[model samples]
Target: MNRKLWTLLIPVVILGLAALVYRQAPRFPQEGSAAVIFARDMRLHHAQAAELSLHLLERPVSKEVRLLAGDILVTQEAQIGQMGGWLDIWGLPFSGRQAPMAGMNRLSMGMATDAQVNSLDTLSPRQAEIQYLRLMIQHHRGGVLMAGQGLKSGVPQVEVLAQAIVNSQTAEISLMAGMLRQRGAAVAVGLPGGSMNGMPMKP
Candidate 1:
């Protein structure tokens, strides 16, 4: 009833209303948001990795290579589904208007070119295994980089998935490198150098 009390009460009422509105606000990634871009691009990236794994599986390869391919196929497919689900939840189209991996080099993304993909079909079993290993290693490197960018998006879901990709793929990269050495081959060169956690990519 007093003037001073009324002024303090008015401020408290305004603060309460603001807090209520904030709590009800919808939270989601916008079209141009980093999370959206990461989801869209990473889905395509995972699709390619899965397809490459399938190609390798169709051939007669070593047991180790066969098992690795199967793992990659399953993991990438699951991740693709996860990212696609996020896009749907955000009410975004599966694909975006911008070119895939926009603002980043395709090689940086470790994507196999049309020619490279076609080349797999022409290789003998042994040759296919070697080619697939090299390509997938490079591809994982690219995924690491993209996922690193995703981590910077400040979206909780994006950061969690991005970190998961970084951890799993980085470990897989090491495994595949060993596989390459066993075959007397080396990882393909000339790709960018960076880890998913903003560090230099490990050899």
Candidate 2:
């Protein structure tokens, strides 16, 4: 009887241990990191800007402004599609349950606030230009952060993509900064870590 009991208990113990091990395994791939998160979140963020670009394109402006906004819209929309493609290929969602910007605390540049985005929408053409420039410059900074991190992390596609983001964004940053000074509204560009159009970074 004792021998029979031990035989039954052996299978039960093995099954119990197997269940525990399975439970402890991670749900997502172990490769999950800033590279993946940024791609997903930034795609959504860029989509929002792309929507605005469509609206602004019709509003009218100088050749330079129209060209700039047009380029931004087209480029970012393609980028969004590209990143979304990556997510699709990787079998990942475009966004997780976490807040877009907040979850990116571990990433480089994160998403802009909804309110900051709204302020961009509210400005008149002249005001909008400055706001767009400043906001986009800052937005690119966030992208740079993610891309730089991806480079350091040695994620293949992410590193290559990040370098591109840095190159493009650096140029935009200079352009916007120059434009701000030229307009004598450099002070209007909010300081980093300030209100961010009244929606402060989430804790």
Candidate 3:
């Protein structure tokens, strides 16, 4: 074949392959519905809460703090079960395709990154407590944003769950804020429920 003809054929072949790939891709989130988005996102949120809670449970802490952490673990575990159950009811996997509303959006309730999780797992008891507090604050912030997004997105599928998430996370946010303050650690936020509380934003 002539060089020019070969070049033209390459483009056509590439386009055909691309089309096939696109067609084969899973129809994720089925329009990114609430049932889809919430199940997908909340799984991460709840997992982190459980992680931090489990860490605290394993650590020796002041009675007050330990008690609080214990409560968080139990409550969040129940909530996690509920969300996972929702996925089963919907005939969706516990984690589904990213919804359009949240596909590009990073969930604020997203728990620790792999590195952060690894660090938490490796730390000593005292350090674990501190890191748990910080990572959890970030995780909660992510949750708050998602819950708020769910509420704002008008997706009826996950609205009730999202609202429940907001209510629960808001309360936990306040609790963590107080925990940060009681530790004499100055956080950066002004609101109790806002994750910025008692910590400085990175410059």
Candidate 4:
């Protein structure tokens, strides 16, 4: 084929393949299925994680905290994009008609309240590191919880993503714990209802 003809055919071929894949993809989750709930709520939860990490990055903090903040920002932003893609592919709205985490037993997913979020701005550099570590520990644990729920979804892709969350966030939590101790702050206690094993009890 001529170069001009090849260029015209390339785009058409790509779109045709994409449409074929979409049609052959597994059946989409129903409105209240674990897949939909996890996608919607986890995206919101990850947005907060990325936002809080950005706040930490803007301040003068320890080298460890800065590195951790940058990692969180990048990682959670990617996760948010992945979950958003899932929602789009499934033909679901990004926000659900029911409340956030509605199918997940109304768990707040350990989100920081407005007061807690606002407090980051007023803290000293070292204090900010401590606070961010504490809040992120809670946030990550919440991710483990949500991801645990995803394991019951029976969707191979969703289960794989959830298991990855369980693995990665559990390790991050341990690292954050060590960092907190280095900063002379105790590790956060009373993590929401779960041991550090990343398995959440079903509500």
Candidate 5:
């Protein structure tokens, strides 16, 4: 009788332990959660920024621009890691079901098309610097928009990362604008509704 009671109690204890472990596991984000969306999209976005920075490093440019490119390369690559790690932790795929920027405003702001990115390989050093600076400034603006969206996520970790992107990129935008001015290149105009320094761009 004692043996029979012990067998039944063993299974009950095992079941309770399983339930406790499941309860303690981290919760995965929903498919459409802001954290998931930001992680997926921003990983791809930061990858592009990393590529552009590498291109700039290979080109002949002023020390100022080189320093800026170095900074972007390090910062964005780390951010890519952060976002990718979040996706892995959440058990989500690297790419999402939705199209890129499907739900975001100012869709064209930061992204460089394949053609634009590929063309950088063929440009002269001076031309590459100018083109890269122009494209990056635009890209940074788009990033700020996405990061702003991330800040609205209720998840504390996601909001912290998003806010960091906003602060860093906003300052970089001003820095890039100054770089463009030093080189006598025109600042890349923002999208119709987008603005530098948070003011709306004029038509």
Candidate 6:
């Protein structure tokens, strides 16, 4: 009778321990998951925006441009921190080994090329302001596009940040457009459903 009882208890204990282990197992976002991709790509994207803003700040920009640059720098840096935190929590590396934005037009993502980024240093203060506005406007548009894609991530945090990005960057695009007009400059890159120098913006 005692042997029979011990056998039943052994199976029950093993099952309980198995359930506990499963419950405590870490559930991380898989490689190439939407949340992981968004977190990684957005960090890189925000870094460029912050860098541009910082560079603009070093020049003798107008009062309005200075304030705008300051705002962008602060906002983007904070978002970068948040995204980095997400990646850490997901048990992922800061950057994936895969090529960034593989198979996508880096421009469509609103990324500046090495040449464009290098050009920022060559401009006079006035030129810097205008160029900054144009580049940043295009950059914001790209951010909006990427954020729109991220909205489908189905991860609560990613979706929330993506929505916030869409709202803020869309408003900033309009604001920058107005600034461009004030400077008597036109946007070098087109907005959504539009063309920049005859090149249509990707949907």
Q: Which predicted model would earn the best lDDT?
A: 1
Worst 10 residues of 2 by lDDT: 194-203
lDDT of 1 at 170: 85
Tens digit per residue, CA lDDT, model 6, 69-108: 9999999999999988988888889878885567667776
Taken over the whole model, the C-alpha lDDT of each candidate is 0.85, 0.65, 0.65, 0.81, 0.79, 0.82
lDDT for model 6 comes to 0.82
* TM-score, per-candidate, Cα-based: 0.83, 0.67, 0.65, 0.79, 0.80, 0.86
Best by TM-score: 6
Q: Give per-residue CA lDDT, model 3, range 1-203, as digits (tens).
A: 89999988999999999999999975433435655676666666676788777866777766766787788788778877876776676567765454323443343334456677677567876666667776666666677666755675455656777887777766776776677777776544422333334463221
lDDT of 5 by residue, 1-203 (tens): 69999999999999999999999987877788888888877877888899988877887777878898899999989988888888888887787777656665534557877777876778987778788888888888888777865888777899999999988988888887887787898885675445646675321
Candidate 5 at 143: error in angstroms?
0.2
TM-score of 1: 0.83
Q: What is the clash tally of candidate 5?
A: 1
Error of 1 at 178 (Å): 0.5
lDDT tens string, model 2, 1-203? Answer: 69999999999999999999999964432235776766776676677667656655665445666787789898988888887787777677776666555544422243456676676557687777776666666666665555555566456776777788778866876776777777787523333644333553221
Task: State, as a TM-score between 0 and 1, how close model 2 is to the true structure.
Answer: 0.67
Worst 10 residues of 4 by lDDT: 194-203
For model 2, what is the error of residue 200's alpha carbon versus the real structure, in angstroms, after optimal superposition? 18
> Lowest lDDT 10-mer window, candidate 6?
194-203
